[model samples]
Target: MKRIHAAPGTISPVGPYSQAVISGHLVFTAGQIPSLGSFDEQPESFKGQVRQTFANLAAILETAGSSLSHIVKVNAYLTDPAQLEPFNEVYREILGHAPPARTTVCVQLWGVSLEIDCVAELIAKENGQ
Candidate 1:
């Protein structure tokens, strides 16, 4: 079992860290921030922030030979729990019926309102490519 880092220049990393890692048949992604191309601005829109965070997580998962459909678990941290409904709406859109086990909690943060971290089980058909 070896750790695989899911970083391919799309996801944002403020410090020295890999975006995600694959161990055996599983992929574990680091916390994702809402960042666009410039990587300096996190928009004021809470919904936009949540979407961007998921996008970052998706990008990392793609690099690890996985996708949102393969996600088995997700842990989200939000600066405000009031935005949870919007977040849930987006989650339903992305994951459809096959939702992963998830936990969302409020946490103190700066310049951002949401963060998403995920674990995915890479399908064997998509592995060893």
Candidate 2:
């Protein structure tokens, strides 16, 4: 059977979707906005939105018993193409050690400038210790 995970202390989904769904030890997550338990339209700036999105991803992954380090792939969408450089800077910080296979694209999002979604594999601790 599959399992679903919802992070602690996060605003309930504003739409019809779970924070994450796990199947056979792999968790598929939905796109995460820069929202921090707020009902407002997110994404204030390139850097701000990117950071918050990663933080949100981290929280959901932690809740699902996984982490960014375990991520196997990431799909990032940018509203403003100009922020690619700054975005890469931040990405290097988070994805420095073991970067995952990723694709970054600039797409239109209801006229917004940022959005990100990633897939992280569960790295079970050796011996379950």
Tens-digit lDDT track of model 2 for 39-113: 474667677777888988888888887998889889999877788999998888898798899899988875446
lDDT of 1 by residue, 54-77 (tens): 877877887787888999999999
The per-model lDDT (C-alpha) reads 0.79, 0.79
TM-score of 2: 0.86
Off by over 4 Å in 2: 1-5, 41-43, 126-129
TM-score of each: 0.85, 0.86
The CA lDDT at 26 in model 2 is 83
Cα deviation of 79 in candidate 1 (Å)? 0.7
Q: Name the regions of candidate 1 deviating beyond 4 angstroms.
A: 1-6, 9-12, 126-129
User: Cα lDDT for residue 15, model 2?
Assistant: 73
